[model samples]
Target: MESGGWTIKKRSNSSNDSLSREYVAETGCLSIVVLGASGDLAKKKTFPALFNLYRQRFLNPDEGHIFGYARTKISDDELRNRIRGNLVPGKGASGEQLEEVSKFLQLIRYVSGSYDSEEGFRLLDKEISKHEFSKNTKEGSSRRLFYLALPPSVYPSVCKMIRNCCMNKSDLGGWTRIVVEKPFGKDLDSSEQLSAQIGELFDEQQIYRIDHYLGKELVQNLLVLRFANRFFLPLWNRDNIDNVQIVFREDFGTEGRGGYFDEYGIIRDIIQNHLLQILCLIAMEKPISLTPEHIRDEKVKVLQSVLPIKDEEVFLGQYDGYTDDPTVPDNSNTPTFATMILRIHNERWEGVPFILKAGKALNSRKAEIRIQFKTVPGDIFKCQKQGRNEIVIRLQPSEAIYMKVTVKQPGLEMSTIQSELDLSYQQRYQGVTIPEAYERLILDTIRGDQQHFVRRDELKAAWEIFTPLLHRIDNGEVKPIPYRPGSRGPEEADQLLERAGYVLTHGYSWVPPTL
Candidate 1:
């Protein structure tokens, strides 16, 4: 499961090693261009994130502006309306807040542009340049950031257009960067091609390969939980852990949005990139430093140790009535649910099975990583009766980290029950607003922090791990089973877990933080 002809060459992309994080963040006048501005992703995520950052003053209103570029021809007011519809001013926003929204709208401007054409990009460059000239001419240099909210089909052309017409390469005091979302590519070859396209125009530092899942609060805390807390240090390997499961389930189906969902399936959509990235963080050797490269370096090392997934270990399923959606093909076998076991071939995780399961249209929408430990060697209580210690890192529906430990029952009887040591976001951070994953990630991009972003070499290694399995599913070598719409998943998923020695214990589920 390794990529050939692409020898690993790690290059730091920092333009100025002298620039401090604070300086990089606060010194420049920033301009953000959302490529697919009129679309759902821009309205639902990109614009809302910029608005929040502006509202909080992380992005200086005077020094910042947002440009919306898309093929849709719309007036500035119409574009603002699209953005405002998604930006709920919250429960009881103040008049000042309302005014801020109005002011933020002023900073937003729209331009109808073709993704592949230089003419439109030149027009976009003009709009961006106006703002750059407006900033203190003698002081801070203007920065340019492009957010590709459009489809991957247009990335190559759009990237070329940006480099040709929009980059501010002369601004040594400032910087230029672009943020791209995943499915990085269709598979290994396509991903490499996309990487090559981006690499040609932008340096590693200038490219932000975004995986919003990594921006999650709990995900970010993995470092502190593993290194800062001594409880997990010695017990984080196969010596203590029985198995690991990264499970993501959505209570609602894509419905009309099956067009995108069907094209990629569960593996490409969630498992390959998101879940595998989480696995790397959970299994990596302790990094030498908290530097972004050091952390990413360790993450890449973990991926290199992963063995290719065996098709026999894969369980794929399609939900009932999935074809009812017009977007999905009538005879499509694209899997809505998939569960696969990945084995890491290194000493720490040699025999440990890292199971990743993701599905849509289930009973509840939740994401969590469950680590089940091996049985106690000499237990006073029956080994089966004694609950093996389990750690759960919940990513959504409420972020939380909790451990289920066996404790003596309150009654006179010496029976045992599971009790939790938990850290729930809501309970701990009173009256605080943890920004959405997009918000945190967008802010990180603005601040030039690449720690959470994926790198080309890392992405290539990830694709190498799953490309063969993808080819099997793509070529109809394996057929997807059918499951009920609201069920957890196919019954075979449960069977697969049992065969892998992962216990689906009952009578204990952590209460999530109040949303």
Candidate 2:
């Protein structure tokens, strides 16, 4: 369908034969069940993404239905009303767009249900089955997708409930899949335990461990940028690259989620999953093929190549007034900010440092990957004083990819100044709506594409790399240094960055271009 400046082709119902047979089921009646529908994730991300798909006609109203299951006791209309405002269209939405939003809202039916109780799940199943039968889809030919947006603590019991009461009636040309949110577990052992519980109920192909960062446009562009481009093939390794930085910064703290944030610090909340996934894309060897399994294999190799994190190269911080949150304990040792250096013990990245940093209540909000290349070896012009070449990929706040280079000052002084070759998405792709991370990911789930999702073994390798450090932090062996709320995180983090070979680019900032 063509709308705005983009054309979204309707996804084919025929499955790819190369993928596992279980996932090769014909796309029949699609029933999307959102568990924890009353939670923030559902209203903020899940529902909004589904609404986008519906608006684009990717979701067929004739064969698709949405069911919201949660512990909150509310009628379908009440649930719709709760999310109606959030399902808003772009600025200056016309009456037709408003009507489309209303029509999408009507497809959602709410079923109040506890996570672990059999009765609640049975009722949810009954509602889903009713919707399926009402469509008169062929017997044993209906697709079911369950999205678990709740905490990891409830995953096991919820999976069991889903297996027992909510699976499709038959396996013939029909499938049941579950999409799980992250902070998968506190550490390696716990992650494995949770994995085993869910694994018993569903096959690997049926479970999608989603990391929204993987769905970002720039992140999704990593493979094409690295493998498809001739310019980066040789310059992407330790030989030409000095250091790589993957950073996530949020201008606000955990306002109402202090209780939950206290349990998982910045490392678990952002670095372990989001930043690491970006790192894998930046560092992994080119896969033999673009198949989901092939791509994931390369990611696992990258994670497995990560060397142990060093204490001297790590910095942790907690913003001032974090303890003021009523839900947070007075003595909570959680770190709202962290900076750590990871070395990959592989041929391509042997001496290069992968600096990962994340923080809350900082100076600004943005996530980006900066790849700083080495200084020119034979520079008679002495451009070294200006700055080294770098490629910065901004993941949010006006997405972009730009290359920093030393260029002659406009005045013919023969002196060099730093400038960039910018590809800011908003400016370059005007009037084109870049799909949200959740929107792309949810569409992938419906299409049975696991390329962006974390595989089982990939998850295991990621946790293994951080489990030791997480344990140390949890045991009070490594305490966080306190920093002011509006300021950049503890100064020690900057020192760590320098020590890890990251050169500071003084007096230069690349601003996103305004249209």
Q: What is the alpha-carbon lDDT for the whole of candidate 2?
A: 0.88
Per-residue CA lDDT of model 1 for 353-454, tens digit only, reads: 999999998888999999999987878676455457899998887878899888777998878787788888888888999887888898778667899999
lDDT accuracy of residue 140 in candidate 1: 32
How many clashes does the backbone of model 2 have? 0
> Considering only N, C-alpha and C atoms within 3 Å, which residue pairs clash in candidate 1?
none
lDDT of 2 by residue, 183-284 (tens): 788889999999999999999999999999999889998988898879789788888999999999999999899998998989999999999999999999
User: Candidate 1 versus the native: TM-score?
Assistant: 0.93
Listed in order, each prediction's TM-score against the native is 0.93, 0.95
The lowest-lDDT stretch of 10 consecutive residues in candidate 2 is 1-10
* Backbone Cα, N, C clashes tallied per candidate: 0, 0
Per-residue error (Å), model 1, residue 210: 0.6
Those runs of model 2 whose alpha carbons end farther than 4 Å from true positions after fitting are: 1-27, 90-93
